[model samples]
Target: MSHPDPWRTATLGNGYAASVCVTPDGDTVLWLLAHGGCIEVDDDYGCCCTDCAPHEQLNRPIPHTMRSALDRPIQPRCSRPRSDGQPCRTPVARDGLACHWHRTTKETAR
Candidate 1:
């Protein structure tokens, strides 16, 4: 199953929202403005600016990071049924459909 994206656009106290995330190394921060702008900054003044692009033309990758924050998937709820026959309210395993208990039982039976 596919999971939601960890990085999300947040409203900056106004009608505007932007996707923000930090690099895995925690040295750089990147954000894409919903108003056709992009911002990137590092510790020093090496990279810092708010570049305004045309509508839907903000296609640029964050630099100096091993993995893109957008590539990481968000946590997903389990699809199993609970004791009351309701959907499970817990998150699923990282690489499996069910949660730890459900997946473990099914795997052990095999």
Candidate 2:
């Protein structure tokens, strides 16, 4: 019997959603959302629930034709200011206020 595809069945409802999908390049990724915001977690971590086993097996890569539909045109930029007092041009890390460099610097300073 063929296994069910998680990406096809994943739904957004009740202010929470989660899914495992494959990129066009064959990399598997997990997307999660809660409370109207995206939930970002470390790459090494995963859901501990027993129900995740079946969904995790569905890693069929997305088609290239679907890339544009999935891509975000406007992403949040880093909020840190440059040396000349201009806003940093780098994109912010997923669900973060600053880019990787600035985020690390800020965390180390605290």
Candidate 3:
């Protein structure tokens, strides 16, 4: 079976639209604005923007406004711990919790 796409597109009203996707780091979501810039939102709902105007307007609570688009499941990241002892940020392989490199190491350990 095919996995559901993680990207979502939403209309932001006033003729503006955005394509939203989770960042590879898995800690932030990126909003690619129609106006040729982007915004990055963290789990705490804090945001940074490439354009000041849109940032001023769309900087409010994002979950309420983009509920439908943000409701989809987030892609799972690799579970292996890194040197800093944090979980790896890489996306997991289709059938496993570890990313490619970590998955190989796991298999070799068996």
- Per TM-score, the best of the predicted structures is 3
List where candidate 3 sits over 4 angstroms from the true fold: 1-65, 93-96, 106-110
Worst 10 residues of 1 by lDDT: 46-55
What TM-score, to 2 decimals, does candidate 2 have?
0.27
Clashing pairs in 3: none
Model 1 earns a TM-score of 0.25
Predicted candidate 3 versus true structure: per-residue lDDT over 10-49, tens digit per residue: 7677554555555445544444344544433334443345
Kindly report which residue pairs in candidate 1 clash with one another.
none
Candidate 3's C-alpha lDDT? Answer: 0.51
Tell me model 2's lDDT, rounded to 2 decimals: 0.53
Where model 1 places Cα greater than 4 Å from the true spot, the runs are 1-74, 93-96, 106-110
TM-score of each: 0.25, 0.27, 0.34
Model 3: per-residue Cα lDDT at residue 34:
44
lDDT for each residue of candidate 1 in 14-109, tens digit (9 for 90 to 100): 544544455445443444344433343333322233343222223554542324555677777775666687866677555347776666554422
